[model samples]
Target chain A: MFDTSTFIRLLPELILLVTALVVIFVDLYARRRTALGLLPGLSIVGLALSFLAVFAQWGTREVVAQTLAADTFAAFFKMVAAVAVILVVLASVRYMRARTRYVGEFYAFLLVATLAVYIAVSARDLITLYLGLETLSIVSYVLTGFLRDDKRSNEAAIKYFLYGAVASAIMLYGFSLLYGVTGTTDLQEIARRLLNGDVLVNMEWLAWPAIVLVTVGFAFKASLVPFHQWAPDAYEGAPTPVTMFLSTVSKATGFAVMARMFLVAMPALQSSWTALLYGLAVLTMTLGNLIALRQTSVKRMLAYSSIAHAGFILMGLVAVTTALGQPFNGLDGVLMYVVAYAFTNAGAFAVVAAVEDGTGGATLDHFAGLVGRAPFLAAAMLIFLLSLAGVPPLAGFAAKLFVFAPVVRQEYYVLAVVALINAVLAAGYYLKVVKQMFFVEEPERAPFAVARSMRWALWLMIIAVFGVGIFMNWFAFMASQGAAGMLGL
Target chain B: MVPLSWYLTVAALLFVLGLYGVLSRRNAVAILMGVELMLNAVNINLIAFWRYTRPDNVAGLVFAIIVLTVAAAEAAVGLALFIALYRLRETVNVDEIDLLKG
Candidate 1:
């Protein structure tokens, strides 16, 4: 018999949903000016408590009626999403209050979006995954246009909505094709059927197309090269907190879905998809870095850099397929990279937001000699840029090393070399930001005040970035364990 | 009874038409309509698959419902964005909204 315990297993998401609704309700009764200040703090506490609840359930695996699978991987991503929510709330307390209206709604949406990401990473069946992705995407669409008074924000929101809708539809169509071919929406069941060899081999042509469509859908979410057209403008146009949310938590969730689907369910079809991932890995990394070099807007540069990092994560996927003749072990690289990326990218965006607060703009020129004006922000930005460039003694370098280690172990020398070259190219642009900040003359009349909450957020993010790198082995172990559980090994 | 291929082919054609509309149309609202058309094509394929392949299981039916709900949410947010853009720039043309272009 179906039981109430099943519903209890989803307590964290329930809490978030309740909090979001309560925030909406409470905002109506409170003074408008103070509500903006009070709501984000309340949401942060709720998110932190939800994270604790999810943490308590770590290592407890359950298949919720063949739809959602509450597992360690879900717990790991939930923790990450919770961290993202906390940082977003902290960053937005100052950023949103000064620039945008409807602050309570904004914080509520962020929490709801985090809940969606949690569900997305945990979804065992196709339907649940689709629902989760759509939820995340919809909230993001609204958040991107939260600054409705800003023309760029409005434009960004429209473009994001149109492109995201198309991608979701394509993804759904692909899911339908898979369902048609396999007659099952449960990933595990589909994997078992495919491994049986008779149905799959007999319908190889149909199977290939179905796989292609499914991949295309996931690829759009991951923002792989060909499907990444929406990222830059959207990241630039959205308020800075939303940009950080999209770049870190949203991208990480996309990879989680990709890892779950391809590594677990579609391992039988590695022969077909592995080569495709390799091509995408090379293209995404190269294109993202090359284009980022020319961007004058700091936000857009990070946007492209995030796309490049997506490519780096794809390399780990490629390693999973080609190296060790298995996909499971390759996930360690992906997990570590994501953890490292979450901290460094969030820290970088925090610095950008701080700079934006000071100068009231995000252009590259605005950051000239930022070190002279705001030494702490400059130092934080330097650390983030260096970490992003994969410099030694930083989390980004450790992430790259983890990703490349398996490739070397498996002797995929050429792929590792390509990744190395991309890393070097990435450093060129990241260093450009650093050089402009520290070595150039201070731009006249740079606004240099950072809100206390934003400053704390930046410090925390920087400390996390450096701490993870310094304790690389421990971080790697946690990442590897999470990956191992996701692969069910 | 209509063959499954007939339904699939029509769905594919509708998807292509939607893609064409999204790519060629300058108006944001038209692009949204195109997106809706594409989602409808997907819904058709899902229901057809459920009817033909997984008749015993209702997962596909459940997924179709979820997709429809999501599509509605997407349209709401999208139209809101269009309204916002219309108010800000007094136009919904995609080409005219390229302020951040390099």
Candidate 2:
């Protein structure tokens, strides 16, 4: 029954796997020749090819051997992951070459990370899911410490590894419990068993612990409150490009998996799970914003703000319901919000990377008089900051409107108001960066030079932020379709 | 045949001990050991459930094998990170690696 179409359907993942292998081998042989410059070009081509593959598979939905699926939902995330990886690779080109000796391996790891995201998002079986998640996590740890000799990078990697291992172990234990009770490792099968009221009748008491343990793992990945200790250290310590990847793609991957697992499997426990998420959503936003407001370092502030954004995204999850009629009503908002966030956050971090490269510092003091040093970067940072603050005519505003629409529709007035206030509180820190860039007096040095590749990446992101905002209806429709496809609507 | 409750009880105890180790231990390696203990508990749960529920299917056995492999990989990464930490600060104690604290 396995046909050529099966392989064809997995073209994006296959292309990514081959690209990673090629990049790895190319690094060893390229040496210090002019050929070294071609590595990034090849990686970009690989990402583009995969993006096309996802496009080709856009409307096709099929489960392959009960382990993975080639559905519109997977396609949607594949495109997101592809865009994020491409932007990160573009940002890394000059940055990685300037810092690290192993340029080829950096690009290779980026591709592998993207490949892992595809696998994780497409996984239909629990084993496949775990494998994908671990692959992504491990690669991410390696990427975080790519600057091996730097103490900060090393510390970030270890802290991330320890926290990640413990969290995944806990989540796996919860998975084992679920498999033990339901006697199936397939996600859809687990849902069937639990919701049908046949398998978990006598074992109803076990379900709560299983869900709680699993949420711990997901919360860590999403960097939600109470499990958010790693974000600031990891974001500040890693190379800025890797931080961009972690903040945007890594966070999106976590949300994608979380949405799939909670909405698809064990949805029968919605009442209990939603209540828990309600509390977590509030804690994550409030704590993240309060802590962010006190941060001095710009990078650490962005890290904390990312956590707060995670809380806002969780509001979409809380708005979800499995009442059999309104499928994916809130989920569409989650997908749109994450995609919009990827553009805005990645664009913002790209600016940080550019400034750090120019000034050798990422502190607010170093950012003083940036308007005179680099006018384009200052303007771009303003765009991204305004977008993050949810100003109109920007992607962040559109993202908030889409996600909060569902919450308001569901009559979650308190949650929506809390999120609104956090957004306002968040603007204070974002404005600090803008104030440093625009309002401070000019430094005496020659104008700082922006790398050609870094400039391109920022421009692309600027386009994406404004493009998605202006084309809100089309992207929102695509997100709704992706959400509907995920639920088999 | 061993009772399912007995296996589950031991697994729960192992998991609890692992959580305690992860929480209370200051040394990085010891905390990793705690994580290992927790993963081992999961393996026991998976295998016990498989043998008791349905031995014909190999999914449980397969899942346990994957978990074992991933655990080994995780340990290798963990140790590598610890070594990197030691090279930087001359210590593997988590409390000592506090340079990035807010």
Question: Model 2, residue A114: displacement in angstroms?
Answer: 0.7
lDDT, residue A203, candidate 2: 61
Interface RMSD of each: 1.4, 1.0
lDDT of 1 by residue, B1-102 (tens): 987889989999999999899999999889989988998898898899889766888877887888888788788888888888888888999889897655
Return the clash pairs for model 2, or none.
Answer: none
Which regions of candidate 2 are displaced past 4 Å? Answer: A322-328
RMSD, every candidate, angstroms: 2.0, 1.4
B22-98, model 2: which lDDT tens digit per residue?
99999999999999999999999999989988688888999999999999998998898898888888899999887
Q: Candidate 2 at residue A155, lDDT?
A: 89
Q: What is each candidate's DockQ, to 2 decimals?
A: 0.77, 0.80
Itemize residue pairs with steric clashes in candidate 1: none
Number of the predicted model whose lDDT against the real structure is largest: 2
Q: What tens digits encode model 2's per-residue C-alpha lDDT throughout A1-489?
A: 668987898889899989989888877777666546888988999999999999987888889767888888888988998999899988887778778888888989999999999999989888999999899999999999999888988989988998899999999999998888888898998899888765634665677799999898888888989999998999999999999999988888888888888878877888888999999999999999999999888888899999999998899889975444563367887888888899999988888888888888788877788899999999999999999888888888888988788888889999999999999999999998899888888668558889898889999999999988999888888987888788766
Q: After superposition, how far is residue A22 of candidate 1 from its true place, in Å?
A: 1.8
Lowest-sum lDDT 10-residue window in model 1 chain A = A321-330
Work out the iRMS of candidate 1: 1.4
> Cα deviation of A36 in candidate 1 (Å)?
2.9
